[model samples]
Target: MPRNRQILLDNRPHGEASTTNFRLIAEDTPPLRDGQVLVRHHFLSLDPYMRGRMNEGKSYAQPQPLGQVMIGGTVGEVVESRHPKYQPGDKVQGMGGWQEYSVVDAGQPGALRKVDTTHVPISHYLGAVGMPGVTAWYGLVKIIDPKPGQTVVVSAASGAVGSAVGVLAKARGARAVGVAGGPAKCRYVTDELGFDACVDYKQHRDATSLAGALKEACPGGVDGYFENVGGLVLDAVMLRANAFARIAMCGMIAGYEGHPIPMQHPQLILTNRMRVEGFIVSEHLEVWPDALKELGELVGSGKLRPRETIARGLESAPEAFLGMLRGRNFGKQLVQLV
Candidate 1:
């Protein structure tokens, strides 16, 4: 039997998660069942949503119970297999979590995808080619629904989901405007990704003053908004949206630390007849093929680029996770375990 190192829930966070709220442990693996596969993690995807799971409160995904292995997305290689469908040495993507190894049932809902990394990095399967990619695709096409010549805006513009929205919007003939934290991210959004404009939110005197900068960036008024950080940022964008504007409400990284939700100008929504809708990409999985095909085509043609911040080793997951929440990462945050 082999020993697996895993991170487990120790305490529920009050607001932002802390290192003390988790525990590291070593466990001996049991004999593989007839229909199971032993997987050694190669990479772990650290995302903003994991912070919600650290709390005992309700959320889109179930909360991680005390003493259970912390939940997350994993890209792993099969070390042993009792299932006929999977063979040893094959790669997969699934919710194997923050651990060195995982014993997964072949028919489980979170099965890993077999990938070939000759053309691209395998970590992408957990990033732009996987869940984050899917999330960006669905959120933009389905939720925001930017039309040709429309002014499209994305918050957290340098991130996986936000950056994808900007690129896709531009490709679809919409004017893409990105809002990021600093000059570096702003330059990446406009110069690198070809956004029409980018507003450096970090340079604003305060979140309250972001609306002025955002208004200047979108003189035509925003038609489609791909939201990532909520609270003040959302309020700012909401104030600048044109009549009949559309908003795709994704993760609210800003408010994840339990900040008070800012009050919005509700009268503008009524007068402008704008629409704000929230969606989970998982709920729209059936529509992914079309979006994925388009995104893949863009990637293949070198139009869309995905940047990733890699943290080596599983033990680095904690710091990587914290860094994402703090906006210290340039792109999708991943912990490479292999």
Candidate 2:
């Protein structure tokens, strides 16, 4: 048995989450039972949705229980296994949480999935080619459904999900426009990610000001929208939206910390005749194979070059997660546990 390092949710957040909310502990790994596998995690994914889970209230998912290992996505290698289906040295991805190791019941469906890391890096199984990529695919392809020459807009455009949304939209022959916080991020959204144009949301103090910038970037009114950061960005997008525009409600990161994100014009949806749909990607399991197939092809062909910002060691997960919440991380934020 090996020593396993885990970060548990020490307490629920009163307002904003801090490092104090999590506590790190070390324990000896228990011997695996029949149909079980032990994985030494290499990477742990930090995502915005995890913030909502930390709260003790009704949400799309269950709250992160106090004094329990914080839930998250992980990619690792099987070091020991009693399961007949799995062998040592197999790379696998699962909900391994914020830990350096995981004991998985291999008999459970979707508990441990073997991954091919020959072309795609194993860490990417937690990012672009995994949940985030599938999220982008569902929001863009299934909800927004942009047509050729139509303009599609996404907020938080440099982040993992938003970056993929813009690139995926461009592949559909639609013009991709991005709204990011800083000039550097905006530049990366346009220059690196190939968005048709990008607006620096930090420059605009209000929705009207942001709407002016969006109008310049999206000469053609926004035909579709991928909402990641709600608040003013959503308002701005609505102001510039064309008739019958579709809006994919993915996340409202702006209001994640118990803040109210009121829409300036609630009547815009009716006036613009827009179709706004909120979705949880997990509920759409039927689409994963097709979505992963297309996303995997994009990554393999170098069409989707997703960037990552990794923090070293298990102890850094809390601070790295906080940085991501504040939009301080450059791209996909991960903890390198190995």
Off by over 4 Å in 2: none
TM-score of each: 0.95, 0.99
User: Model 1 over residues 263-336: C-alpha lDDT tens digits?
Assistant: 57767788889888888887886976787677666666767788889999777888888889999999889988
Residue 17 CA displacement from its true place in model 2, Å: 0.8
lDDT of 2: 0.94
Taking the candidates one at a time, how many backbone clashes does each contain? Answer: 2, 0
